[model samples]
Target: MTKFADIKGFVFDLDGVITDTSVLHGTAWHQLADYLGVAWSKELADGLKGISRMDSLEMILKAGGKENDYTPEQKVELAAKKNTNYVAEVDKMTPANILPGMKAFLDDIRDKGYLLSLASASKNAPRVLAKLELTDYFPEIVDPASLKHGKPDPEIYTKGAQLLNLDPAQCVGLEDAAAGVQAINAAGETSLGIGDATELGAADMVFADTSLVTLANIEKHMA
Candidate 1:
């Protein structure tokens, strides 16, 4: 059990950790792939986790052998289209889309006086936060637009901790992607891995889903 006594705050990855937006992202990618006549699979989409939207577009285009002809402007346009689709889908998300026990955990943490922040590679993070009505929960949002590098580099997480006025060791990072877990670990913070355990082998702790990540569970680890 990892102790949370030293932790002063919590930082979360929006897409998979807070909401079921991973499926929406994958769906949007597949839609774009079909429009571009590219082969897009869940495996490829999964591999693109924690990367920026532009980078993801480039990867998918290169994989489809269509990277050479597409202009930068075209790539931007396509990415915007994907966002449009994603936004429409996100608007339809009800409370049901929020992972189980996440609300309870978030309430507990906030009530306990832990500062909360959001660190995500998504450029549309602000929009997503607004749409989900989760804007009030996070005081600081360090996103792709705020950093030169994305996950696997630890810059985002490091900056997040800096913005929150908390030490890396005093923050708990929650993520569902392996890259995110790596980023948290590299930042010297405790990472609670959510979702599929096989992919997040590097996480300090693993839970099957948000439902397993209760305040009691966190306290137990901290103890």
Candidate 2:
């Protein structure tokens, strides 16, 4: 086992990592597609994971053979509608909705004084954290709206490390999507991939279940 004792900070991707909001996001996207009379499937929504909402919208448009049909403003409006749908479920979130092991893992890291940053592709990250009462663990959170690109691009992870005053090499990134794993690696950090190992090839380690994400386990696997 590798000793990850040298790691000083942790960068976490939202959605699938801290909470199960991916289903809500996928539902919202599907609703928008139906409302717009466009075709969308769960498989297509799967591609939107770890990606920005507008970028997801563009993909949807292209899937519908209408990518160039809508002007930028129109696409923005549609994306806003999708966001509205997403927010309706925000109020439903409570601490209980946080993954089984996330709260404990976060508490452990916080107690250890590990600098933590939440890098989410969702602009709703702030609200989600507030609703889940997990905002205190994250002093720095990347606003996807501010970024011109989304995951698979290393900007978010790099900025996360920068905000923590740590070198990317001194941080480990946790994500549940392949693009996010790539982002972490691209930023020169070790990547912890949650969920499917087959889908997270870019990660340094993959855990199918969250229950095993303890500090000891992380150190062992991420070392």
Candidate 3:
């Protein structure tokens, strides 16, 4: 097995990697769609996976054929409403909501002395981390609000590497979305994607799910 000798840090995306808050986000969006008389579908929910909040809202609005119906202020208000719903559900999340094998993986990463930080597009990332009781492992979370660009842009991953005081090349980024894998690659970091291998082809390595994300497994499989 090839060891990841040069890797010093791991930058993680929150929603799908740490927990499944995307369901809450989709539910919130669905509620907003209901308010706008728009039909919700799985494809629309899937499309929102790794993008910024405003971008997700824009996609939903366009899908509803109501993109032009609201002023900028009204759109912001609508997004806030959706956030309210998402927050209500996320606040209910406990460590039990952490994905399978993820807690052990986190403990292993921590014990092994790798630097850790977060690069999630979600503004609620801090809250979710706190809810999961995993904040001690990640003190630096790249602020989504401060970023000028979102996933597929590399800015968030680049900033996350900066937070760890490490070069992007010395870090490995973990994500569950195609856009996120692209961002990590563009940032010059090795991407470890957790999800469908075909969909996350940009990743340097792909695991079927969080349960398979062990470090030993990664070194065994990653090139």
Score every model by TM-score: 0.84, 0.84, 0.87
Please report, in order, the local distance difference test score of every candidate based on alpha carbons. Answer: 0.84, 0.87, 0.89
Q: TM-score: which candidate is best?
A: 3
Q: What is the lDDT of residue 126 in candidate 1?
A: 75
The residue-by-residue lDDT of candidate 2 on 106-222, one tens digit each, is 999899888999998777899999999998888799777778767799999998899899989989999988888999999999899998989997688888977778889877775
Strongest candidate by lDDT: 3
What is candidate 2's local distance difference test score? 0.87
- lDDT by residue (1-223, candidate 3, tens digit) is 2248888899999878989987888888888889989889989988987666799999988998889999999999988998998999899999999999999999998899999999987778899999999999898999888999877999999999999999998898999989889999999998999999999997889999999999898777654
Give one digit per residue, the lDDT tens place, for model 1 in 149-169.
767888888988988998899
Return model 1's CA RMSD, one decimal. Answer: 2.8
> Which is better, 1 or 2, measured by lDDT?
2
Candidate achieving higher lDDT, 1 or 3: 3
